[model samples]
Target: MSKVWMRTRGWVRRARPLVSLALVLAVLAACAPGPGSERADIKIGVQGPITGQWALEGLGFRNAVALLADEVNAQGGPLGDGRSIVLVEGDDRGDADEARRVAERLIAEGVIAVVGAYNSDATAASAPLYDEAGIIQITPSSTATDLTQHGYSRFFRVCYLDDRQGLFVASLMATELHVKRAALVHDGSLYARGLADWTQRYLQEQGIEVVYFGAVTPGQRDFTPVIQALDESGAEAVYFTAYWREAGLLVRQMREMGVDDVRFLAGDAVNNPEFAQIAGAEAAAGSLISTFPLPRDLQSPEAVAFSSAYEARYGEAPQSIYTLMAADGFRLLVDAMKETGSVDPADLAAHLHAIQDYPGISGPIEGYDEKGDRIGAGHVVYVVTEEGDFELFKP
Candidate 1:
């Protein structure tokens, strides 16, 4: 054999064993489980506006869910099985059409559960999709009463229904404000219309006359016609059942239009920091908002801890009560998962329904009724201070 040929043969012979050993090691490594390999990731969907006029509330929902996810993961996940929670975010832009698309996307992504679609319209649109897909949905702020009437066993909300809020508003107007005549206005959205209708019913029950029950196109800036209507109606109080932006604009316009004698009351949707900014401190001051307890007003240990954590992470306190409610929804889901030890939609739903007096960051959740409506949920009226802060209404 040639000298070069012999050298090549020797080299091949020497490398053969090394190559075989490398192959064996690679096979062993491939077969063996690595760190976190035994644990699977649990996917949860966080759906909301995220980028529209209600982006503040949507962003709060996302942030609160993310924070809760981080905390749960740090604690060895929901079942303490080393499985980590993976959050999938779907932004519906606070529109029903977009919410339908988001719902499909989240279902396709294989999310076991969802928390959001902050607007009632969005929630109503996406709820059917979730139900059909066997996914659990928990809304933090969608308060339309009809949502629970759909017979969707997997759907629930951490917040009270619009009917409850409406009753509270009507009682506040009758007992505290002593208004004999009220004007009702809505933004033509599901939440706004539902709240307005219920409020009108309760107000009439209280022997208060509803002089004007009207709808305003959402996102409209000028309210000259509505202000004129309010003036003509001779309403002692104006109850606005809509979001903060519209309520703020309407209130500001009313004050500027010399409609000063009318008391401006808003629904839970108006409990936002930007309300005062939009309406101006002078106009927003003394305005009553019927809503769940504000985060600043909550004094429970769980609430205090959540608020501190949220502030520390976000560099500011929660701007809306919905933020805390969003956190509560996430916690409720996790608690159900931990208690049931299963991610199956049916198990989670059943466990949620069975939950009683569950301590939540917002308050004690006294379980869900057969319709998935939150039981023992209550509302309180808050007055806007001159500094644009929400304080409990003593009167």
Candidate 2:
């Protein structure tokens, strides 16, 4: 009996290695990427100037994307497969070189889609990189028309084009403001130059003569020479296709220089609350800006809810309209992903192009045309109030 027991113990010890090998193989098969394997996290990238002059705009976009991602995750995430959305942020500092580098880094990080780089120049410079990678890039605020004209199917924007915005302002100046002549100034940047040219052209087409068309260095504070030119031109309206900083300086100087009789018009760049703060309430009052409608004025439940939620979360009302666009752009991407049941950027782009009249917080995203420009999307007319807030322009 003792001999039999020793033999049995040896047999069991010899079989232990074979049993352990079978268990290891089973575990390996389960862990490998194949049928019934767990899905990895889906990554979405948001790139912007988180530390530069335009950091507010970039941060606003990043915040909106975060909000959307959180909501999606809270709702059990995408595809109902336990797969979650992970947000990866890249700070481009609003520089072209940095933007390209950031774009490449995000691509390497395995982001399927990206939303960001607020400025037109940054977006224009970095778009080719994304196009080469075939990733979807939906800009929340880059409005330069040439961005779409490049035929990069991967690029799309929720904002209106620079030319369309300029034309909208020109139509208002001619039909509503009833101006016979207007003065125009550009910041010499691609966006401002293109906007100024288009607005000038539209004014000319409407028989409203452009009395003075000139350029100015963006960061320059002294606008006395430009104000003098406008004053000498006998223009009934003054349109400056520049940003908030220069717009504020120009408006303040014009007021001080006794050019208050003429209507001061500005572009979407001055649509922020900072514009009013910089220009002063009294000076900013009655100033008209071609912009997108504020969330409060949008009247959609989604818009209203978004405004309230954002204010609650951030402890302040959204100062820039780009936040709304960013949220909408993110929703479009996620909605596409959900609908197609795929995380592929190409799938998202196809669904985005096919999307028609997507009810958005900003407005109805009427889908993208062949040029990737928003179809049937236009700018809103806003006037500064005494409280230094945007009010829907009745006229």
Candidate 3:
């Protein structure tokens, strides 16, 4: 062997044990959880209807949060110091009392933040609890007009407000659908009343005749009475401002009562697969809905990637807009946490208010206004196809 070869061999022999020791130590480090790992796992409460009619939306939010937790933690989570997310599930069952209970429980659990209450009525019911506790509560859905009106600094929502949705629907009715005479029906709930009232005002302002205005006791089995009123009033269209469960029943009842020629329009709450499930694909066809941005309308690369990842992880496509908004809500919280380097709701609230043009999978949030309403948030128009899926309305 040459002199150079002999020297190289000696160096390799001397370094071998040290290199082996380093490899063993690295493996041990990888196997053992780090010292700060336990402290770093931040607990966030996720509240929604896990067992009621709106359970699908709640479950979707849970799945989206789980997916995001996994993804964020893989990159070292919000703090980027080996921190991770730990979600505490709160099932509100879509009831006001249950929602209040859930909110109180989450606050008692010492969670840093909360995401929940898919329906606006439930959200409004629970908002006081979170606000009193000073816990940052970001809802993935819930679009009642007055959600942000109470001036709760910790309360925020990713979806557009009911006023925007109602306005858009009224415009669609006047200019596109050319609705002249209509009937308005709403469940006697805060959400339904606010949305329906706004739409009714806008419709009348546009010179559309509101032939019948009525309210229904939600969870009632029969909507035939309301359908008969619409028929008698000779309404060219019927607008229902409520959740899918009631909307589905009302639509089906209207069809059953031979109110076929009158077009049906609804709000964001009906933008779910359960709507079709309850109304039947045949019954749901040709209904127009006002809602947040649909997955098909998302053109951002982040949105496209998120949709693909969500499908791959869940083994199915997302059926509700809440899933995307839930993910965005979580992202917004985490981003605030990172920016402020604190889990304090007050700090999160400040950061949230300051965020501008946050690129989210749902859509870019232009930040919160003085009342905490998301600036630049708007609604889209969709029509249910024969197959009972929402597609962008051409008209």
Candidate with the greatest lDDT versus the true structure = 1
lDDT of 2 by residue, 92-117 (tens): 98788899999998887777788876
Deviation from native of the Cα of residue 167 in model 1, angstroms: 1.1
How many collisions between residues are there in candidate 3?
0
lDDT of 3 by residue, 1-395 (tens): 11111110111223456568788667655545332234545778889988877788998888888888777778887888776677878899889988988888777666778888788878999998888888888998888888888879888888888887777878888998898998888998888999999999889988998999998887887988888888999999988888888888888888888789999988888777678778988999999888886776797987888888889988886767788899899999998988888877798899998899899888888888866778875688788999988788887
TM-scores for all candidates? 0.90, 0.89, 0.87
Residue 85, candidate 2: C-alpha displacement in angstroms: 1.1
User: Could you list the CA RMSD of all candidates, in the order they appear?
Assistant: 9.9, 10.0, 10.9
Q: How accurate is candidate 1 locally (lDDT)?
A: 0.87
The most accurate candidate by TM-score is 1
RMSD in angstroms between candidate 3 and the native structure over all alpha carbons: 10.9
Candidate 3 weakest ten by summed lDDT: 1-10
Arranged by TM-score with the best first, the candidates are 1, 2, 3
Model 1 lDDT-worst window of ten? 1-10
